[model samples]
Target: MFIPVEAPTAFQSFTLVMPAVAVGNVGQLAVDLIVSALNMQRVGYIHTDCLIPMIGSNPYATSAETAGELHTAAEVYMAAEMKLAVLQIRSPIIQSKSRKFRNLLVSWIKASEFSRTVVLSSSHGYQRDDQQLKGIPLRYLVTPALQVSGDTFKELGWIEMERTPPLPGLTDPSTEPRLSIPGGGITKGLFLDSCDAGLSLAVVLVFCSEGDNVPDAFTLVNSLNSWLHLVDNKGSQIWKIPTSWGLLFGSGIPPAIF
Candidate 1:
């Protein structure tokens, strides 16, 4: 309801905590879009399998030339609450009996001095303008897991909204921003643009754990300057979607499949 008249100007590195499930690929998409928007360097990409104990499994985790690659990703994920945000994207079928497992996972992620976190799910391919969201603010848009049957982890409330797919005819920002990337391949990016109105607008993907579904709506604060609203074609909330990683070679051509 409150839209900014101008953009903000304070730039801060934001970490994105996403599920390590297939849906997590959604997270990659979201990050890629953000990197292009903000023109900032890609932080890091953490592959968290569980949160109860807060463990990161970079399956392909390897040493970088400067180690800054992995460090940046870890830093951003912890930026919200200085800890990791728990996402239930582990499996598509919530087993309904995984209540205990889910609790442990949430507790473990919370144990760490969490700065703040926002939990999101993957899209059902049902693209719409906007949807309704309800919940109290915690730190960074952390909310209840959607798409899950019944109310299992309702304790961790979250907001909801409509889904927004990537727009058509968008530009590829792998090198234009010209930051630095450690890991190669089709990596996604996150873009946080500060507007002149003391407000910030983030165009990012809602990366969820494997089974976690994309959230209908969520809120973001601490814009480079202030706060701003990012709407979709129907004037709904708009988030950055990671398209793909760059080749780092080959004329830096545009990707075929996003």
Candidate 2:
């Protein structure tokens, strides 16, 4: 359920952006960048039992005064001027409740009446097939309801995610190609659900590995910006890195160890 900090109705017709807990946490990291860059205001929380419980100080806190504010596993932020709302997921979903979580998200999105939704996600780079290996590591998928023109994507120079054929040995001529997103948690499922519900949704994802994926995050977000024009990328304008990312790798080495 959504517990609001302000009027829930404020989100009407807004575009919703969210992340999937995928490999290297690329999606989540990308979301952190957006929230930090926009300095979006907290609007609500998606309180549910489907995700593992988590709570901590605000990740995007600008100063000591705001640093202690309580933040939960899933929270919503908004930039009304941009008609954008972002849902940041901080914890993993309970394996057994994954489906429940997806259902909850779909129901809330429908109820909120968002103009469109974009999901950020990542898959294992090593899993890419021959065709996938040839171009840029990023890919996108749009539902029928979005009704986006292929010309739009073509103009943006974006590539659509491809459906791969069956493995060599299992190649039955009648067998169909399949859409696979290895390591993208709940992404494929959520996309399919949106398709079934006839919702306007699109997915933007990257192929990455399990490591320091900060660069991949920037790449994915910049690609989205090419389409959404979320922020001015011209001149010196750049995506601001969140302060919380300071210790992403770990603490400093102990002098005693030297």
Best by TM-score: 2
TM-score of 2: 0.96
TM-score: model 1 vs. ground truth? 0.30
lDDT of 2 by residue, 109-226 (tens): 9999999999999999998888898879999999999977559887887789999886734567799988899999999999999999989999999999999899999999999888
lDDT of 2 at 87: 96
* Estimated TM-score for each candidate: 0.30, 0.96
Q: Candidates' lDDT values, in order? A: 0.28, 0.91
Candidate 2: Cα lDDT at 157: 74
Q: Write the per-residue lDDT of candidate 1 for residues 87-169, one digit (tens) a residue.
A: 22322323342333344434433343233333322322322222212233211221322123354224334332322234433
lDDT (C-alpha) at residue 180 in model 2? 93
Model 2 lowest lDDT segment of ten: 164-173
Superposed model 2: Cα runs more than 4 Å off: 168-170
